[model samples]
Target: MTQPNLPLLKWAALFEGSSLLALIFIAMPLKYMAAISTVVKIIGPIHGFLFLSFVAIILFYLLTRKLPATTTLIGLVSAFIPFGSFVFKAKYLQ
Candidate 1:
């Protein structure tokens, strides 16, 4: 597979980060505080899909771009942390 272009990476990162934020700041709160399961049910799958897509791109670039092991590791790890993908994009992907 080819390395994803910077624009593609940026777009994916933006979407993945946004989904993570919504899942955490919107869905989680609604699920916990308001006893609302619907938002979580909706946002959770969306975030999961976005996150997986972001990670797949990361891995693809890791091979095609020959990224350092640390950078690859960071990309994967960031997917699990809220706002991490945004920070990663700014700090490393740029």
Candidate 2:
């Protein structure tokens, strides 16, 4: 069987982490403080997509046994924490 693409997973982690940061730090503030609901409308779905994609890729790695349980667990759990994905990537992927 072929191996999973670690580089792609790393990139997914980055994109997912950045999107979360943007949503929380930028979009949410703009929505609440500036009454610009459109920012949340735009960023929410993008973040959701990236989050799902990142989780899916991590699950793929887990199922294929490409990564250990602890690493995969970190990858999955990190999705909920701000900048967690970046930390996971730096710790594991690098």
Candidate 3:
């Protein structure tokens, strides 16, 4: 059986993934290299919020939709690694 498509999760995953990239690539570089900490101060909390939202959405789907545990594990792992969410969406969320 095919799983239901979750657009919210897809968007959340995208946002979370981009935020992580922004934090690591843009924010960190500016903060450390240019001695400008303001960018991190702005991006860090945004990334954190996006990450939490992504995890919460994953948990909600796992419980309510009865998704496989491995999917949940993959979703959670995706939140940590930059761009992992995009891969997860392409592979699983389709």
Candidate 4:
């Protein structure tokens, strides 16, 4: 059986990436700098879930779609940086 490619790949990719950015840039900063842990308490779990989902999607694309190594690498790497997913989509996910 073949799994269909993720139809909303770009949207999911952007969302996952954005969530991570929000956690790192917005939530973490708010938690540490302002003595407010509420943001991390809320956003941390959400970001973790999104990150896992994103990686799962990337793995699906890699195993099922047989994406090129370079493309797969970009997709995997993009999850680490704040704006990397957008760049990855613009360059490779097209």
Candidate 5:
């Protein structure tokens, strides 16, 4: 299998970071401070899609790059926890 391109992985990481920031800083705050249900209603689906995309791209990277099984398992497991992608980025991506 071919190695995962670093550029694509970097882009995916950046996208995930920005989406996470939006969800945490903008959307969640809006829900609480402004009492706006739509904030969550809108951001929830957007965040979900981005999260799924991140996982899909990460899996693809693992397959193509032939990353270690333990690393892949870590990445998959991290997806379930809040702020877990940040941990994955810090530990694995860098």
Candidate 6:
């Protein structure tokens, strides 16, 4: 991969990781500890942006690299689930 593409991939991974942490640790706890819906109120927008970026990066990578159709599909679909990016990183991204 080129240097330019590398940053996008890395950012996508970071966004995904942060969102996962927010969902699991911050959001989940907020719901029970304070009765505040932090996930939907605060973390939602952040995760939404991350998910969008992940999709954009996937499209950009697909166009630039010779990625398999299955990989592309997996990357696209994985953005919907919490911690999906981590799974993608473990299973697909090297």
Residue-pair clashes per candidate, as listed? 0, 0, 0, 0, 0, 0
Model 3 CA RMSD to the hidden true structure, in angstroms: 1.7
Q: Can you write out model 1's per-residue Cα lDDT over 1-94, one digit (the tens) per residue? A: 2332467677888999998889889999999999999999999999889989999888887787656678889888988877999988888777
RMSD value for candidate 6: 3.4
Say which candidate scores most in lDDT. Answer: 2
CA lDDT of each prediction against the hidden true structure: 0.84, 0.88, 0.88, 0.76, 0.73, 0.74
Question: Model 6, 38: alpha-carbon shift in Å?
Answer: 5.2
User: Where is model 6 more than 4 Å wrong at Cα?
Assistant: 1-5, 38-40
Candidate 2 wrong stretches, greater than 4 Å: 1-5
Listed per candidate, the RMSD to the true structure in angstroms reads 3.8, 3.5, 1.7, 4.5, 3.5, 3.4
Pairs in clash, predicted candidate 4:
none
Q: List the residue pairs that clash in candidate 3.
A: none
lDDT tens readout by residue for model 6, 1-94: 2223355666687787788688778887888888888565778778778888888888878887755667888878878766778877766776
Q: Estimate each model's TM-score.
A: 0.80, 0.88, 0.89, 0.76, 0.74, 0.72
Residue-wise C-alpha lDDT for candidate 2, range 12-69, written one tens digit per residue: 9999999988999999999999999999999999999999999999999889888878
Stronger candidate by TM-score (4 vs 6): 4
User: What is the C-alpha lDDT profile of model 5 across 1-94, one tens digit per residue?
Assistant: 2333355555665666677788889988998999987987887887788788878877886787656667777877877677777777666766
Q: What is the lDDT of candidate 6?
A: 0.74
Q: Compute the lDDT of residue 56 as modeled in candidate 4.
A: 81
Q: Candidate order by lDDT, highest to lowest?
A: 2, 3, 1, 4, 6, 5
By lDDT, the better pick of 5 and 6 is 6
TM-score for candidate 2, residues paired by index? 0.88
**Clashing residue pairs in candidate 5 (N, C-alpha, C atoms within 3 angstroms):** none
Q: In angstroms, how far off is 71's CA in candidate 2?
A: 1.0
Steric clash count of candidate 1: 0
- lDDT at 53 for candidate 6? 81
Q: Pick the candidate with the highest TM-score.
A: 3
Which parts of model 3 have CA positions greater than 4 angstroms off? Answer: none
